[model samples]
Target chain A: MASKIRVKNLYKIFGPHPQQALKMLRSGLSKENLFKKTGHTVGVHNVSFAVQQGEIFVIMGLSGSGKSTLVRCINRLIEPTAGEIYVDEKKITRLPSQELRQLRQKKLAMVFQRFALFPHRTILQNVAYGLEIQGVKKGISENRAQAVLKTVGLKEWSAAYPDQLSGGMQQRVGLARALAVDPDILLMDEPFGALDPLIRKEMQEELMELQEKVHKTIIFITHDLDEALKLGDRIAIMKDGLIDQTGTPEEILIHPATEYVANFVTDVDRSKILRAKNIMIRPTAHVSINDGPRVALRKMKKEALSSIFVLGENRTLCGIVTVERAVEAVKNKETGLQQIVQTDIPTTTPETLIQDLIPVAAAAKVPIAVVNEKKKLLGIIVRVTVLAGLIGGGENNNNVGSSAESGNNVKESARSMDHISDPLPTSITGMG
Target chain B: MYLRSNYRDFFRACSGLIEGAVNNIEALLSFIPITVFILVLVILAWRLSGRGMAVFTLVSLFLLVSMNIWDETIRTLALVLTATFMALLSGVPLGILASRSDLTENILRPILDFMQTMPIFVYLLPAVMFFSIGVVPAVLATVVFSMPPAIRLTNLGIRQVPAEMIEAAASFGSTPLQMLFKIQLPLALPSIMAGINQCIMLSLSMVVIAAMIGAGGLGGIVYRAITRLQIGSGFEGGLGVVIIAIILDRITQSVGKESPEKKAA
Candidate 1:
């Protein structure tokens, strides 16, 4: 993927005589020592990262960690002490003021943490402000703002002032304001930080849903680990004005690169982040599709199991046959196990979240089969595996496929499923 | 003294220019029939403040008319308006400039303090020295005396605009000028209006002091009545000044309150 925004060696020092501080920093002086000695605070220091096109690149850190300062540096809202910034491979750090403004107007927009809707403007007017400042005609800008308002679900509130709306709705107006300009990139500075938890979650889901449609490259900043994990395609953890690690949510969770990152992930709810493929074991005993009922029963008895999955060519899961059904079929002189096989068993993709699989596991009489888009059985996740994954037991599951393949599969299933609300399919009909 | 000695022609030209402006405004006010002017003020008060202020404005102006101080009242109103207008014209932009730059703000702070704290009578000496004891000097003195609040409040208002709000505007790529007009000025409206109200009231008070320098109006009436001890006419002239002060204060204050919503609507 092409990088949408790239910041290299970015540093922002908040005080006069930053050059002296920069010299001290280059000589390996510590942030605290430098601050104590110089009375100059380091906001961001030696930070570097690239945001891929159409991806949510989250920067996670606590307050005073320079996350906000770093984001402001991108749009030149706060001038960086030193750095190079490239958007679409064009160096923006050295652009003149007029060109920088054109860049902001044409390609970038921001959603503020406080919603920052203009108090003197109606929702529609606030949303239209970016366009208006760009000198767009009033009628056209307002019409565009109206459409963006509808997208953020604030259409009816367009006539109301910012103070009249709830915090959530006001942020929706903020989101609409950024979207009104149809910028290619969005710089969101903890956009949900001020919202209550419930509203924040709702906004996160809506942002993801909106991202699916718009596909804008988004750089999201947050202090909340769960929010970063839930929304970030990739996350960079910052500490003391520097990046400690940057990786996928799974990578950050499972194999934290630094002690700080490890401590940060310790409290995360594992079930929500771990996926089905991470826990599923290789199915040991199973029946072939051509197996007779007698053979199936014998296999189940020998494996010390009550039931067994029946497989077709290419290891495709056909169905499951319980020992009782197999035995009954045998006694009735059934030649094949087709009549005995139960095709109405639950199944899930390997990319499905374990939280989504818990209820399916609780209700299923048989182990849930993990399959891919081709419906080829990858592995089987039994009730114990599901429970084990929830309690962080699947950290070293050897049966898991390559991470890249599973990552792509995750994107595919995520697009197909209604996020977080619905469980995986309870009954995927097996190939007869 | 050095400026008066060396720049006499410049001072005379400036005085002439100011005299023209004040006379034009005074003539404009006098040209409007008194009844129509009263009607316009009543309607403006009704729109800006409410019906109660409108009624008060009507009754008070009628009282001024009955007291036979109508022409003096018009003349005073013109001087006060011109002075207030000139004060705002310079003060608002200076305030904006101060808000934008720390150096400018620091430089302006003590200057504004000096302008405000010096007694109103002290400015008359310079005014008369330059413009020679007429409506021109009176108007100039009033502008000087009343201008500090306009500058101070404007600076305060723009500075008081939330930093995040300014960031929001900047993030949208607003130019400095755009940020001033679109965000800072509008958000600062209430404060600016308070400044304007102060300016008008100060101008009224100073215009009376300007009467000692021979500027004629209700102040002249009050000055004459006071010197001769005509208590009834003095009270009448004072009443006219009070009525005008109340009306302008209420109207300007309401403009700030109403404008935000009006713009939103």
Candidate 2:
């Protein structure tokens, strides 16, 4: 797949002689050491990355770690000292002023952290600002702004000035402004970073759902790791203007690329970031609805398992049948596994967070079923798997990067049953 | 001296134009009935400010007329307002330029300091030498004296606008002119108004000193009273000047605070 954005060897220095500073950075001087010695601050040192189309890529770091500087470089809002940035296969770093403006107007939009809605402009005018700058007709721009405002759930606020709205509403107006232009890539610099925790959480969920519908590639910068994990398809952690690591959240949690990343992920609440699909395992033996109760018992016995899940047509999960139920049905001359099957077990989607599954898994008679939208049995989350996911380590190992890639591009996985099938139901212990 | 007397015909031509402006202003203002003039002031004060300020303005102007310096007060107003208008014409653009470039600001700073800090009496000597015993020199001196605040405050206000907001505008690809008009000017309006208010106050202060140069106004009345030692006329003229200052200060201050957007949030 063609990458949506590619940044290569990006270097930014805050003082004169950027070229000399670039040389010093390339020679491996640390940001602090360089600052102390030469008095030139390094913004981003030798940073390079590619964001695939439709990816929510997060760059995370502490304050002054250069995350904001990195995002600005992508759009050339702050000219990089020396580097190249390519967007949509076009080399953008060297684009002429007019061309750069065209790209900003037509393809990319930014939402600021402080809700940079113009105080003088009404909500509708603020939302329509990008279009207005692009020379779109006033009437059309206003109509488009109204529609986008409705998308962000801020209708009836068109005529109100920014001051009349609350912070969250102002933020929505900012988002509406960006979306009104229908830009393909959204550059958000800690957009929800200033919101209260509850509003931040709500905005995170809203952004995720919005992405599901809009399918815009998002570059989100934040200092909050949980928000990064919650929103990022892949997160890049920055330290002292250098990208320490970039990987799936689970990959960072389990196989941290650097000691910095390791220490950073240590505080992350794994239960929330890890999904049921991350820890679930495939049931080795299952009885089909067409098979009799004898077939169910034989399958459970052959696999050395106490229970076997029953699958109907099209891989739809029918239910789980234990040895006792199968044996009793067989003794009574039960015709099929249908009568013996237990469908009372809770079912959850692959995306359900492990924290939400704990109660359901604890109260269940058997393992919880992880099903897809079509009710097809994708995997199973047993009590041990849920417990393992909560206490994350090698036991909770998941190929999240590959699985996510597969999930996004259907042909890559086409029912990627390999996720859970390799590790049978009973073997997933301590994935947490 | 050469321009005023040596070039006799050129001096007459210039002084004649100056006399026409001063005379027209003096006559036009005093020609209105005293009640009508006060009524206009009340209306103007009400429109810009609120009813309270309007009432305050009415009382002050009435005091000017009752104190028997009504014509003299009107004459002073014309001189002060004309000087203020000329100062704004020159000051705002110089301010905008100073705000834009460091070089311009550095150049303007020392000049404005010189204009503002020099004694007001020092200006009268130069005024009397250039356009002896007339209103032309007085208006010119007032413009020089009052123009510095407008320029300095405008520069400060523009520079004080948040750099982030300016960057936000640029990131949207706003042209240089668009950024100035659409962001900087609107945001800097209150400070600009403050600069104008200061200019008006400074011009009014110069009005009395201008009388010594033969520019007649309330300043002339006070000058007469001072020379003759007529204590009664001196007190009334002093009272008239105070009333005029109060009205202008109140009106301009209200205008400076007018922007609802800046005032609200």
Report the alpha-carbon TM-score of model 1 versus the true structure: 0.85
> Model 2 segments beyond 4 Å from truth?
A280-360, A363-382, A391-432, B1-24, B31-33, B261-265
Question: Which pairs of residues collide in model 1?
Answer: none
lDDT of 1: 0.86
**Model 2 alpha-carbon miss at residue A5, Å:** 2.4
User: lDDT tens digits, residues B93-165, model 2?
Assistant: 9999999999999998999999999987887786667667789889889999999999998999899888867
TM-scores of the candidates in the order shown: 0.85, 0.82
Report lDDT (Cα) of residue B140, candidate 1: 88
Model 2 pairs in collision: A388-A431, A388-A432, A389-A432, A391-A432, A392-A432, A395-A431, A396-A431
Q: How many angstroms is residue A70 displaced in model 2 relative to the true structure, after the best TM-score fit? A: 1.5
Tens-digit per-residue lDDT, A1-432, candidate 2? 889999999988998787887788778887778788888998888899999999999999999999999999988889999989999989999888888888887888888999887887788988988888888899999999999999999889888889999898889888888888898899999999899999999999999999999999999999999999989999999998889999998777767888888778776767777787776667666779889988877776675666778899999998888878888998899898767888886899999987788667545656678899999999776555554444445444443222322222122122223443344344334333
What is the fnat of candidate 2? 0.31
